[model samples]
Target: MSKNKIITVQNVTVTISSEELDDYICITDIAGVKSDQSRSADIIRNWLRNRSTLEYLSVWEQLYNPKFKVFESEHFKKQAGLLTFTPSVSEWIEQTGAVGLYVKRGRFGGTYAHKDIAFEFASAISPTFKLYLIKEFQRLKEEENSKERLEWTAKRFLSKNNYLIQTDAVKNYLIPKSNYKDNLEWLAYAKEADILNVALFGFTAKAWRDANPEMAGKSNVRDFATVNELTVLSNLETHNAQMIREGRDKKERFTILKDIAEYQLDILNEAEKIKIEEKEETEETV
Candidate 1:
């Protein structure tokens, strides 16, 4: 089930459900702010019947939803504002291939729309309510962004620390063995980094960029790695450094590093599973 959050705008509580791409706010709850809870459906229907509302919604669908049926939307647009014409959430969805609005039916059921559409609906209900809704939504996003930055910083610190360990080993062990000129010694360090990347991530740094040209503008592949992958990469860095000091061949080191990466990831995943199961059991008991 998707996690749900409640945000109060001008003393009226509205529910927002999270999904993969965007948050969906309960439009019916917003409707209740202008009318009684019993009249939410009536108010929504009346709003949907307005020609202006249909035009605005059609523009939104065209901009975001590629599969939006232009023919069907045009048909609805012409029928709008007629005395006999009335529209409902389900009827609109039936005509248009829009994932923008969802009619959830259960204990916490309501007419939910994507944040973009919901904010527009809020503006129609009351400008004051719309302002507060945007304010609360921004507050939620800022909190989430802050938390994510802190986690990324922590993992990056771990990766950098292991990098220092690896570099020190290169200076003490690999440099003397290779007997390379001062200007060419940096190549060995770059080669050592690739060894770890290939062993753990199955791609060299250059190879990753070649495959993801769009992402290359913003970051390298490691920057988008999962927490588990970062952890394994950090471990591999230290282990590769030690292996270098022991004078292991590249083929032998790659084989050992790959096995270690797999083993450590399995262990980490198992531990995470146990923690989740324990938390769920506690919640059920409570």
Candidate 2:
């Protein structure tokens, strides 16, 4: 379940619910600020009757919601700005299959809208209120991003530590058995690490260096990895270390790690696709 956050603007408390990368703000709370709480739904209905609002909503749905009912939206478009064209948020959602706005029940219940739509709704309240809403929402997002950066740095550190564990396994189990001088021990470690590099990234450290010579001196492939890649890399390192202790050959370990990398990365990538979709939606809004 998504958690709800509260942000106050102009002394009115608004609830924000995060679903993956999309943020839904409580438009009902925003409406309450303009008038009384009981009239929030009426204010939203009046806003929905505007022709420009209908056009904007239709464009947004077309860009992001493949299943959006274009025919139904067109029906609404023709009636927009007409005195008889009053539409509720729930009615609009049900008719157009709109994903931008929704009504929740029970705890934290209200009419919630995507940040893009909520900002537009705030404009109807007043330009000043809209600006304040944007400012507070941006502040909340900045705080979240700061926490995420810290967490990512901690994960990267853990990945590096796990990498050391893998290298130590290579030094103890593989180095002594092979004919490698003390001066060449680092080569053995590098080669073992390459197995993981290739499994997760489809390239070795040297291959990455050769491809990007400018960055080679300053950073390696791991430095360019995404949070998801780093997470899988850490797991691959731990698994490779255990496999090394079990006397598994490089070829077998590589195959196993490759399979694990593909599986884990696929799941993580799927989970993160929402963020990418949200970015595209934001770009379209811009």
Clashing pairs in 2: none
Worst 10 residues of 1 by lDDT: 173-182
- Quick one: best TM-score, which candidate? 2
Per-model TM-score versus the true fold? 0.58, 0.61
Candidate 1 residue 68 Cα shift, in angstroms, is 0.8
**How does model 2 score by TM-score?**
0.61
Per-residue accuracy of model 1 over 1-286 as CA lDDT, tens digit each: 4789888877888898986446899999999989889999888888888888888888887876767898988888898879999988888988887667889999668899899889988889998889999999888889888997898688778655654455554423321122122233333445777767766666567766666677678767676555677888878977876775455666777778878988998898799789999999999999
List ranges where model 1 is wrong by over 4 Å: 159-286
* RMSD over all Cα atoms, model 2: 17.8
